[model samples]
Target: MEKVHFTEEKATMLATLYGRALDSREADPVLGDHAADEAVRQIDYDFAKLGITRDSAVSVVLRAKPIDEWAADYLRQHPDALVLHLGCGMDTRFQRLAPPETVHWYDVDYPEVVELREKLYAPAPNHTNIGTSVTDFGWLDQVPSDRPALIVAEGLTMYLTPEDGTELIRRLVAKFPSGELICDVFSKLGIKAQKLNTPVRRAKATLRWGIDDPHELERYGLDLMSSLDASHWSTPDVMARLRPFTRFQLRMLKYFPALARMANIVRYRF
Candidate 1:
């Protein structure tokens, strides 16, 4: 393995991968991603440079879990759906979910990241890797539009300008006859606070978009189905199981409306 020279935006994928790998190693993991753990072992990068800690990794996994759950549910209903994983990075969601053979899965990302993924992971019969930016609509043409679809954009929206993100969603909704999208959004405060986010700063990436209300997406002609505050410390069951100090810190965020609104997981249907 050699040092990967990914651009700042592409490098952010390493942070998420590191987070998933960290969570996978926990005794009682929040979102165990053994594939991520394996990928981490295979990649030759300085994990320390990402500044990922146990606590931060937990946050990352927690935010991802809800989206995974939603996708799982969608797949159950439409096992043959097309799954478009935008900004796929080195994520192993397809391996984790293992949808039916009838399903077609496409992992879309920058060419370099896709190239790295091809080297790191084995190919699946129904899985296609699209080497292109998610903001580029041309990649969407490579996917079939005549089936139910599940589009996932994890840890990705904030990197796109609001107009670009909205346009992407609008295009997807209009392209497919019926489909669902699961993605995360940052609040105005969260975007501002990214300046202090260790992994983000280390990656030299800046947050570009935020939304106060999930309904704001309706402006793009999407039907906002639901949204959940996905802060790692916000879930009652997860919080109750944490150490007292951790619980206390999370409780403070939960009780404070402004802070609690920082991050959210939203689902939209077309």
Candidate 2:
């Protein structure tokens, strides 16, 4: 028998919300700031039908939190920076970043996800949506080079080989003279284990990346900023409610960066 997991774009959103719901539960005020006022609860309901559990949901939600938190803080450092979200899927990061009218925002992804996003979210004057694969270099020419930029790639990396991931970013950083980029990278272990463990997912889109050291990307042209732990972002109280095994894993991640490498973020300079 095979267990069910979310489809690609849907899984990405579920993952982003999972961390967010946990943050929301922990009373992180920033959590509220990142949520789309017009879309929060409705997005929650849409995910409910997927049958993913609360804990599973929280894990995914945290994916955006670290970077979302970073984006919020990033604004304080550079208010007018442009933000480019790769494989933007259906997630609402522009609303999360709440960029000023002065900030330029771009949401990009496959034509399919962008199509679905249009049904739910319409771009404001400052926000733009482009339907394109990250592998394509066309979108880079569209964003202005005159201002600093921050880029995020959520659940899209796991579908690409490490080589392609590095090249895509190499070009992005090269295309934009100054910018910070953050993304979640899944390892070969997680993909192999998840697919073998859940047969239903293996038949769908594949999980392609599992590189542990996102810093390795420097050779490809991106400057390393930070490596974030997927589990460490959780507060103590949230950790307590997790299953004993999850609690143990959290503890391990806190003390051990290598373990954290299993699921982590690599921030880089352009």
Candidate 3:
């Protein structure tokens, strides 16, 4: 087994990876991520210590499904697009999407995370792993700007300070001529509540950026297209697979817009 020593924010990725693995083991799996399950089994770490439950595991997949569909849709339009999965932890999205060979995909993350990924996953055609901090602009030079870029930043924004996060988005927008960006963001209130989050608290990671308004990204040369509340992250099929209590909580989000908007998945075109 591969032993891990990730701490703070880096350690949090393991919790999410384990969450997906747990969901894959469910009777009615949300992600059905066998790869994640396999990766979890291969890694020597204390997953239970992260306190991820069945509901939270399902929540992880729910946040990812729509983003997967969006990425696939973008690929359909631009088969030769440059796909950038920023801060990609142990996510099997590249495997899940299975984009055409015409597309170039890059999984950008810390060097240590990429090293772990290399050990676990097989290399895919037209895919590259760049091991560097996403905030470091030097890595961007390695990515070709000729093609339209599809940027997917999930569970990553809040970890960055406003200056770093905003600059990252701006730099990405400036890199490509056209494409869409998909990301999930917590509201200011959600940032305040981060301490209460079990996995985050356990990992000892601090969340800094919270986007209360999706339109705020427009300054970075992105046009706001659409946004989905945590409520819309699920469908009937997904909800049916979840436990009753979790189902009830999700349903209640529709009645409380404030609570629902506390976390959202937003899409933007540049």
27-145, model 1: which lDDT tens digit per residue? 87877799999999988889878888776776788888888899999999998899999999999999989899999999999999999999999999999999998888898889988
lDDT of each: 0.87, 0.67, 0.90
RMSD per model, one decimal: 1.7, 4.7, 1.2
- As a TM-score, model 2 comes out at 0.80
lDDT of 1: 0.87
Best by lDDT: 3
On TM-score, the stronger of 2 and 3 is: 3
Tell me the deviation in Å of residue 91 in model 3: 0.5
TM-score of structure candidate 3: 0.96
Candidate 1 stretches with Cα past 4 Å from truth are 231-245
Score candidate 3 by lDDT.
Answer: 0.90
Candidate 2 RMSD computed on C-alpha atoms after optimal superposition onto the true structure = 4.7
Model 3 off-target regions past 4 Å? none
